[model samples]
Target: MLYKRGKTWWVDFVDASGQRVRRSAGTTDKAAAQELHDQLKAEAWRQSRLKESPARTWDEAALRWLDEKAYKASLKDDMQQLEWLHSFLSGMKLPDQDCRASPCL
Candidate 1:
């Protein structure tokens, strides 16, 4: 379901495990909110059916990559660059990505 929170829109739905999940649809437009809601719901259903691990957030993935590169000669430079990237992004998620396998309400 799509609802307005302040000036933006949000989606709230029950996941496969029956937990309530609420997240920002990231837009104020009704049609856009509905599209986002559908996308998130479909992705959740697909993952549950396929028994795949939950999608990872961009930040989590980036940090994981940094951690795995301890032996890289430019690790320090990479870390600094990552910090800058994260700061710029504010919050990072792919346009249609839902980064939760379990209900992360």
Candidate 2:
């Protein structure tokens, strides 16, 4: 299902794990949001069936990586590298940022 909040479109749907997932479609247009929702549903189904990872933004993945390393002994070294990477990578969407490679294809 699609809804709007402050010019942004959001979707709420049951995932393959029977978990309710709500995510922003990243657009204000209803048609585009619906299309994104449809794609998200399909991706969820595919990930559930094939045990693949879903789509992710670079920031999302990077933050996750940082979180995982929060307790590491070499966290400082990791942070230095992560900072450099963050600076190098612009905000553009990465086509292969997800854990699964080319799952959309």
Clashing pairs in 2: none
Candidate 2 ranges with C-alpha deviation above 4 Å = 55-78, 90-105
Superposition error at 72 for model 1 (Å): 6.4
Judge candidate 2 at residue 59 and give its lDDT. 75
TM-score for each candidate, following the candidate numbering: 0.63, 0.60
- Candidate whose lDDT is highest: 2
The sequence of per-residue lDDT tens digits that candidate 1 reaches over residues 1-105 is 889999899999987767787999888899999998898888787777777666666688687888899899999999899888888764565444344765444
lDDT computed for candidate 1 = 0.80
* Model 2 agreement with the true structure over 1-105: per-residue lDDT tens digits: 998899999999998889897988889899999999998888889999998765566677688888887999999998888788888674645675444655564
Cα lDDT listed for each candidate: 0.80, 0.83
Query: Candidate 2 deviates by what RMSD?
Result: 5.3
